[model samples]
Target chain A: MAKYRQIREDLRALIESGEYGPRALLPSLTDLTARYRVARNTATQALKELEQEGLIQSEGGRGWIVRPRPRPRRHGIDRYSRSTWAAGKAILIAETASQGMVARQQIRELAEVEAPEVVAVRLGIPVGTTVWVRRRTTFIEDRAHQLADSYYPLDLVEGTAIRQVDTGPGGGFARLEESGERLDEINEELAARMPTSREAIDLSLPPGTPVVELIRTTYDISGRAVEVMWSIIAGDMSSFSYRFKIPD
Target chain B: MAKYRQIREDLRALIESGEYGPRALLPSLTDLTARYRVARNTATQALKELEQEGLIQSEGGRGWIVRPRPRPRRHGIDRYSRSTWAAGKAILIAETASQGMVARQQIRELAEVEAPEVVAVRLGIPVGTTVWVRRRTTFIEDRAHQLADSYYPLDLVEGTAIRQVDTGPGGGFARLEESGERLDEINEELAARMPTSREAIDLSLPPGTPVVELIRTTYDISGRAVEVMWSIIAGDMSSFSYRFKIPD
Candidate 1:
């Protein structure tokens, strides 16, 4: 194997093994050169390749540090619990709160658009039905984290606070409850796959990194899907936790 | 811009859009060539790349077919219900039963091994404590599905039936229950990442295909860890579904 390839694979294993946590600094280029007995240029190239892959970045005096990863706390089943959302916090915020990280949302745009066929199916609405789409880029510590494009039936949300630039306290789901429908359950389907050309550019994911394509649907007590959301999550940065009872 | 890349991206988008169901046939190379106005060689190359990516495969006369992906039934929360297990079937079997596929476990080996530090932490046992490990490679329709290695403290099972090649009736967990512990809950942590070099070869996962790294800890009524399992699931061939109630 090429010297750089060997070094790259070793470092990759270390990261995956959780030996290096998010934002943890990796061995310096000098350390790599001495340990791997390779030329400084070879060591530098290996690190460069890893950077291009989006797994690491040079932090000036801090040298190369693992890109801020989504820690274990970013994913929890209780994220949407009434206590959390009704308390005026976004589920995303609650998901990452255990890490002591504050998340901010930048609403890029909000529009009423025709729902795609897939989204329509999930919402039990006619394809092409006008839907309210709130597009936002979520950030952790001001760095891009995930992209959320949430769709709701326009007819249902048009006159409500959900149609506003800010959905007020508790966000959309809480407002949905205030609209007289209570959210009873949520369904999430997850898949790991390479990002689309758009996602790669938008998320700044490194090469060889996959994205978790998450489709979430929120259902009211009437079993109606009031919200269908598509989230593009950076794979390496996140982990999802689920706790469920074994039915008797 | 390469013609093949254009074709590949379009087809990939279509797959991700759920336009084609599992095992559905993709457009033929001839059709792709005509539709995209690309040379036959270019279209073939596109299909070839996708095949290498494990997104699709070609059967002799059937042309290109979407690789068999895990349907929604494969990701039910009820998979571990007592009824399902007591019926003499693995939860994984129940998960894929809706697809009309039978899964067979090829138990590669069973042995008593010293617990690794991580496993020891999860199992609440001392590091290097003797433990029983049942390593198995699961197959669906004779294709490798996932690798599961389950660990249990030797002291808890040295005199029980769980140490045998076949933990009769339901499964090891069932036998564990019979040995006086009642399962209370399950905690699963899921991460998506590229498979390791050994995993790629063992699971026959295609290059660039990510795997869902699932670490599951099964706890007894008293909240003690009884078993710790690590499952490496092929990303493309699997889907995970979670349904949780929003607290009232």
Candidate 2:
């Protein structure tokens, strides 16, 4: 094997074995070169390969550190269970708490804006129709993990808390139910894609990390799409699980 | 805005407006340079940006062409409904037919191998247990769209059609049902990440493309894990939709 590839494999094994835990720094380039009896460039090449594999990241002059694999936020069907949210348990808080992390939802932007073409179609509203949008960044352990933008038709939430920055307690769905909407079903469409530069910056994603785009439309008893939420979640930090019966 | 960014935005608007449809060739470097009155490098930078955004790809000496946005395979819950598959309707065939395309499943490998750790854990079997693995690549219109590896316990499928390269009619699930193990439910876990070099090559993925990893476990009526299938799907070519009642 090439000298650099051998070194990379050695380091990869160490990282995978958890000898170098998350955020743990690897040996300095000089040390690696001396230890492996290789040139400085060869040592650098080894680290670069690992970085490209999303294993470790260079900390500028401080050398490379193992990239922390965040506890994946599992989005199970039960997360949206009406009983859980209706009882005043916020899903984000409950999720993070179970993982022993603090959670915070920052209301980034809340305003009445013209609905985007995609959002309008999901909400079954007219193109260019005015809608109340509440955009927020969900943070786990002070690190941004998700960007969610929720849109509601102006007429449906004209005076409701869904138009506010903070929808309180059980979040927007509970508020919708209080207004007599009676939440019934949710349709989620998921796609994986390379994040746009803007999303990469907002989510602090590592290079080579993709993001999962989830568009969830919640419907009421009348089968009207009451809320449409678009979420961009750091793919490395999340997994979604769905359980369903085999329909006849 | 910088000159390259300005040119990029102009091209983006044109592409978005469908003036430059999928697979349509973009203006040549020389044509762009002359029209924009910019240096060759500036024009190159603009095209590079579009490539990075996954909107275009270089065709060697043929210049750049808009990347074809493959008709996304929408995986609704109905795809797995018993009626759809039990009636001899292969989901992939039905899906591509609806999109006016042909579908083919290429069975690349069939072997009895020692179960890997993750597969064993999901299958509730001991590690290194001998299992049957059927590996296949699903192609849409002759383009590889998905790679699926399905694992089954040897004892369960030792004499079944699942051990064959062709599982006939309804595929492995159907054969399992015919063996008297009635299918009950499915649990799917999904994540997204940049593909490995091998996966990228197998999928013919372009730069900036990601892959969605879906690990699905099928349970029998007795709640035993009958099969575990891991699928790697080209992210840009597919979307998964799941609809379910909001659990009480």
Best by DockQ: 2
Consecutive 10-residue window with the lowest summed lDDT within model 2 chain B: B46-55
Docking class of 2: medium
lDDT of 2: 0.86
Shift of residue A113 alpha carbon in model 1, Å: 2.5
lDDT of 1 by residue, B1-248 (tens): 78888998988878767897678899887788889898987887677666645567778787988776544225667777888776777677666776788787888778998998878989977899888898899887776878989998876787777777777778877787888889888888888876766787788876557888888899888998999998888786777888878754
- Candidate 2 runs further than 4 Å off: A1-56, B1-55
After TM-score superposition, the amount by which residue A37's alpha carbon in candidate 1 deviates from its true location, in angstroms, is 15
Tens digits of per-residue lDDT, candidate 2, B1-248, equal 98887888888777867899998999998998888899998898788767756778999999999888777878777777788778877877876687777889999899999999878999999999999999999988788899999999888897888888778787777888888999999998999877765787898888667889999999999999999999999998889989989998
Misplaced by over 4 Å in model 1 are A1-73, B1-73
> A103-166, model 1: which lDDT tens digit per residue?
8788877999999987999999899988999988887766676888899987678688877778
lDDT of 2 by residue, A1-248 (tens): 99998898889878878899999999898888998899998898688667755778989988899988777878888888787779888978876687677889999999989999879999888889998899999998888999999999887787887877778788888888888899999999999887766787899988667889999999998899998999999999889999888888
* Residue A240, candidate 2: C-alpha displacement in angstroms: 0.3
Scoring model 1 with DockQ, what do you get? 0.47
